[model samples]
Target: MKFTHTIKAAALVGIAGTVALMSGCAMSQSGDLNGMKGGGHEYLLTVTRPNQLHVIDTETNKIVRSCDVPGTFGQGTVEPSPDGRIAYVGTNKWEDVVGFDITNCDIVFSAKQSYDNVTVKSFVSLAVSRDGKELYTVQNPTRKLNDRYEVMEPQLAVYDTSAGLNAKPIRTFPVDRQITKIMAMDTGEVILAGNDVQAINPENGDIRILTLLQNWKRGDSWTQPDAFAMHTLGEQADEFILPYFTIKWNGDPGDMEKAEFWWGMSRVDLKTGEVEQGEILPFEFIVFNFITDPTDSNILYGAFNTLSKHDIREKKTLAVHNMEHTYYDLNMTQNRTIYVGGTSSDISIHDPDTLEKIGSIKLPGDQSTSAMRIAFLK
Candidate 1:
């Protein structure tokens, strides 16, 4: 039977109410079920305002559990362990990293980045190793003096995940400024996105530029590309992809009216350690974030005020669906269902083929720049 939009909305409300009522139940009940081996379920992980880490079961479109996280929430960036058991979050106003055991909602690991009169902040930079043994974040510190504020050089802080509670950086290395995203590759190399896409050796602090983004010499007709790397949604596709924008002079370089805006993507393969980037499409609309299809690398989905599907090789957009509001993050499950969340409490789900909104998962409060990530539980 075909259900109307009104009917589906009503049914979703009913399910949400039931889940809310079940919220008071013991955590162990759901923990035991999620802890079972070979469960093979995909769960959505995100944080909402007022300090909450929500785990939504994708199959039922219901939030199974909302765990309480320590410290205040700010730029809520969550990095789930490779095993999907622990979630490392950047909270406490971006001054600390806290790892929560999703199975029991226990605070397993915590690292305070700031100490003394020096204030440190990691803006959306958090990543866990594939083996789940090491956690990495780039910390920008500023020392407040009696009369002046001194800005210190940024450093990459590495923490051992097993260092439960009050974890400190086991090793620190200097890195470039403006790095907002970090990802651990299978080869034990860490990738940083900022002024340029760079790969750094975590063991020795050696760094090499994989792609020249802001400093790219794409001829005199093209301006410097601008891109921001905030969301970590590469796990599903096993590749870290970032979209960038640049303007090209159509005719005379001195003429401003003939400028053509373009959008491109810089990608790093997590498995093969290969780096490649190129223009995907001429700018038609704005996209806050993008996620590549797990099954097909050529296909891409973008989210913001609209949901768009694109073919990178063809440099064409296959479909575009206008959204009700803006979303800052985009992710997909193994089944290819696209999930868009940010700037609101609800996570909107869409059909991969039609690009149509199929369902929505309502959260407890506003997401407020939080990252929405997918994790598989087994």
Candidate 2:
């Protein structure tokens, strides 16, 4: 079940014209010196159908700007620059990277990964450097031959953010397969999640597994861990955390019913490059993504069919509130207001302590698995 958008020539021309007109208006507004000041407000960045990047002010829970992003909307994986001025999104059926100036909706940087006979697609693997000077993506390529498709090796492509309009990878290195998410750490390492959690140095391409998921070893009684994370929301907690489920035998090794299903969390500290893993829950439930509280690292929140809060250190569920709909991604503001998004147009807000529904911000179209990211404007 791949999400894609068909491109048409007439629609492309119309979109280009609309962007040009918007750029003119932006320039006119920029000329007013009184309009250029910082409010130090926080905004949520998300993309919706038909190629639109929506920015909502967390304070007002209103759509402040809807930027025109070139290319067809696919995964809509977005990563805001460190300064929060530019937003880079995965679009064009997941084959291109487009960066938009959120203030004016101008296409500042563009990179098409697919060309010629090889079709390259990036599945939710996007990140930006701490200094906002570099961008990273894991490109999975396949060659279309006359007979069949040849699967090629995946590569981690790095791009200079200053490369305007038409951009290409300044450097690319071979990476492991099945990578769905990549995040830049303050320690200058990019953490990748796939079969296993890995940290790769962008400078020399030195890669190492920070934590094992598929290749985990917990004696012969425990089964291999199964985990998947697609959304990038760990910036608030400053740690990339992934939840995994595994089975451990409680009684007889050959007994089927005596198996204990366990849920665990694997965390990588973005600040110190430290790795840790431990059991969070003794049972399993549906949880698409989890976010840790920046002020309280022991507290974590998860989103799916229900919103849940957990105290990982104490190994207890603090709260669980059933949601009206499924939300694939979860994020939090500096003040601890919870926001769950993805799989729909509306981002539901909740109280962090009680998991009570407080407010919601509705977009113009369905998010369709787009990543929900928080950006602070100072």
Query: Best by lDDT, which number?
Result: 1
- The segments of candidate 1 whose C-alpha lies over 4 angstroms from its true place after superposition are 1-40, 254-256
lDDT of 1 at 22: 45
| Model 1, span 1-378: residue lDDT tens | 356888999889767645533441333235555443335577889999998999887788788788888789989899988877778889899998887766657666779999999999999899888888999999999999999999999999999987766689999999999999889999898999998999888899999998999898878898888896868768898888888998899887767789888889899999888997988887999998888998999999999899999998898999999999888888989999889889998989999999999999889999989998877765
Candidate 2 residue-pair clash tally:
0
User: Against the true structure, what is each candidate's TM-score?
Assistant: 0.90, 0.89
Error of 1 at 303 (Å): 0.7
Instruction: Please give the distance, in angstroms, between residue 64's alpha carbon in candidate 1 and its true position after superposition.
Output: 1.1
The residue pairs in collision within model 2 are none
User: After aligning candidate 2 to the native by TM-score, how far in Å is the CA of 23 from where it should be?
Assistant: 8.0
For model 2, where is the 10-residue window of minimal lDDT?
31-40
Candidate 2 Cα lDDT to native:
0.84
Candidate 1, pairs of clashing residues: none
